[model samples]
Target: MSQIPMFRESFQHASKELLHWFPGHMAKGLRVMQQKLRSMDGIIEVHDARIPFSGRNPLFEDRLASVRPHLFVLNKIDLADMSRKDEIVSRLKYEGVTEVILTNLKNGQDKASKEIVSKMIDMIKSGTRFDRAMTSPSSYNLLVIGIPNVGKSSLINRIRTVHTKREGKAAPVGAEPGVTRAVQQGILVNIKPKVYILDSPGIAQPRVNNVVEGMKLALCNIIHDHKVGIDIVADFLLFYMNKAADFRYVKAFNLDNPTDKIMEVLVKIAVDQNIYHKVKPVTGGPWMEKLNLEQAAYFMVRKFRSGELGKICLDSDQLPTHTTATLSRQRARSR
Candidate 1:
């Protein structure tokens, strides 16, 4: 429940109605973000530690290569699979990112933030000192980039200690998934060279096949938005849990006969949660109507990343095509 995004009404409806509705706005935002990125000395690339690959932006990678050096930040380590932290760390390093820093950026602890800042300084002084010398009045600039809802704004708020900014004045940082649709700067003064952190919009992965698959990759749990039960999420978790952990998840939930069909599994969960009201809709009355069980199961497995499920990595792998991929393959055949 705590993992649920804020402003539940809008998110719930948006999740249900427009989960796959990514428009040109993201492409437009990416262009703007790249334009703004030219000023920064390095990128503080944020990814969900749990799903690093999915959060990466290939466009950002290509665009930023010429602009600045990058510090790949694997954030939200607190919520990640404790057992696999070393493996995740190793995997990221293997992915051509040597300066990976594990952090719980949203919680705003000073120790982690300070270490992040220190790491940035060390990297800059080593490789970016000559670049810094060229600017007339250069301040230390770091581009904070990530996918939507990956805790970028929350991290900024914690670092600066300033809350919402006033109208027509410099705004205090706030946390919305895509809050910084256009890039904005936040100043942190403690560092010797003043730190100018560029907060950018969350970047969307390029559609691999069609928009629907892209939606599934970006928003996640698209089926849960349209459906009432957590069955899809459960099935997804069960499917991946077994893959990642090398054992099925049915034993944890105690479902003797596990079905691959999400709806079938959801019915079992409804019975287990003891809130399944047959007289009412399958959504389980008003209280559970908006509940997203698929997301819930993902959250539980996320809480304990024991590798019992299959390697359930969402991002940081091959870009997924899903429905969009299927459509693209079909189009290619026709061509």
Candidate 2:
């Protein structure tokens, strides 16, 4: 079966804001997340394959450190580079995360993925060298978390293969943030039923709490907020796409000159595709290239996300060295 298309909802500022939560709801959710963390033999931490770091719940690891033996679920592998995904899984394992599962939940029935999940669940039940539960067939609770628009619900739907209320509307997919407001649970059963996974609401990183983090998120998405213009967001994407496309690809497109400016490369693509509109200058010097580069970048990301870019993954190998301490310092200055 063909892979299901992923749905995305933009939560550009939700991560930074104190997410509006009723006192009772906040207390209840935390109690549930913590309670589930305790009784369960193992935890499954789900993240988007594209932006793994950004998709991480900033507060989750610390909250569940005591609940040892968690599986790192990297979903949407189809949108990322296979080699880079391998490298990331290895790096994460080296960084104290032992059990990692790579899956393109869009195509859940794929046999290899089923085997990976089975083996990982077996390992989770078997107990790891560092795990506290070395002698038991304990119940497992998988906590599926990620940034907004990373296909959490779609994955759940695929795994369960049914349309339920928690899955929401069926015909038209949502493209806005917080579609899955509360936590929902589902059972994963094949041959023997033994694992449960929770789909949590998308948690976004707050707006450019710092300039650098802000830029990273903006580069990935064409964000629109009072603080930044659509042009700047578009410009950032253009820069990254040009930097990412191989030299051979660039030369094939007849863009042989070396320039760090993303706008220049975009201009070349616009001209080559004949996407430019000619507007005569009153001074009669020349007709300016009328194509909007920002729109081009937006479409490029859309194409990339939709897999029309031919399995291309952008900037997946580089790891950001920004530490929590550095982020905290930058946040303090912003305050």
Candidate 3:
């Protein structure tokens, strides 16, 4: 653990305002999802396994989840420290989550792919199919939902490849958040059980109530980097790395000790890795190359997201123990 007294006690954003990042597409996608609930047999709510608790939209619980059989899939497990997964799952179950799944969702077939397909089929077999009334189809229709860039598309593609005998992406995938701009329907993943998935645009809350949660989401690439500001995200990454006592970054970037200051780290990364920016004055001066801190921070954040800095769980120390609604209210009140 970071020595609390040695490092900064808390992270404070300069804005001191709520981080609200709902775009036009998210609002429209949500409306589309609520209308499609009657068509869904089950729900697979994907989240970053590193942030098992943060960045989930409580509105999803209120508007869409109540009427469906829900399964929470915490994705990106390859980049998370699962030492406390039992505690995480138990706490989620305590909050009345029907089921929780941990997934790695990589380029090739993995155990998680098969497990997700099997479990969803089982949930459809056993759990209630809400608003579909008495009649149900032989194949299952599952809706995939989560905050942005938590690997929802990757999960669907993995299941499709492993179970459906398909060879390519059924849904679009990208490195940045908000790549999924629309709610697409009937992405088939299985032929034997006749399973199909509906991929929805990732939705964030209108306002992120807590700054720490917002920082964590930004660090995990769930929020757009530009929207959160790369410097702030890098600072949070430094803070959490110290808090977790994960010094892999020190070796990764050839630093002597852990840093709480992101600027120093970013500059060092730029110097060591030769990252720079070309600038030309509006007055028509010659172009000059300068060490770019933002680019370096982006590089560092990518390292964390890609697991190059080492396996870290940004949310393990801060999992929400209370129900989603209760925590939402508490966070709102604090704001």
For each candidate in the order shown, give its overall lDDT on alpha carbons. 0.52, 0.51, 0.80
Please give the distance, in angstroms, between residue 178's alpha carbon in candidate 2 and its true position after superposition: 3.4
The true-versus-predicted C-alpha distance at residue 307 of model 3, in Å, is 0.6
Ten-residue region with minimum lDDT total, candidate 2:
1-10
lDDT of 3: 0.80
Per-residue lDDT of model 1, residues 98-172, tens digit only: 677767754534466556666776776677444555543346777787766666766665555522221222323
Q: Candidate 2 has which clashing residue pairs, if any?
A: 15-204, 15-206, 16-206
Query: 1-335, model 2: which lDDT tens digit per residue?
Result: 12222322222323332222122333345446676665555555666576665445555576664355666767667866554466677777766677777778657465534554465566665655435545444444556655555666666555444322234432122444456565665455322344566666655543334443454444434122223444445444444444443222244335554344557756776777666656788989877869866555554445555654444344352554446774464334322
**Candidate 1 Cα lDDT to native:** 0.52
TM-score of 3: 0.87
Decoy 2 TM-score against native: 0.61
- Report RMSD for candidate 2: 11.6
TM-score of each: 0.64, 0.61, 0.87
Report the Cα lDDT for residue 49, model 3: 83
Clashes of each: 23, 3, 0
Better of 1 and 2 by TM-score: 1
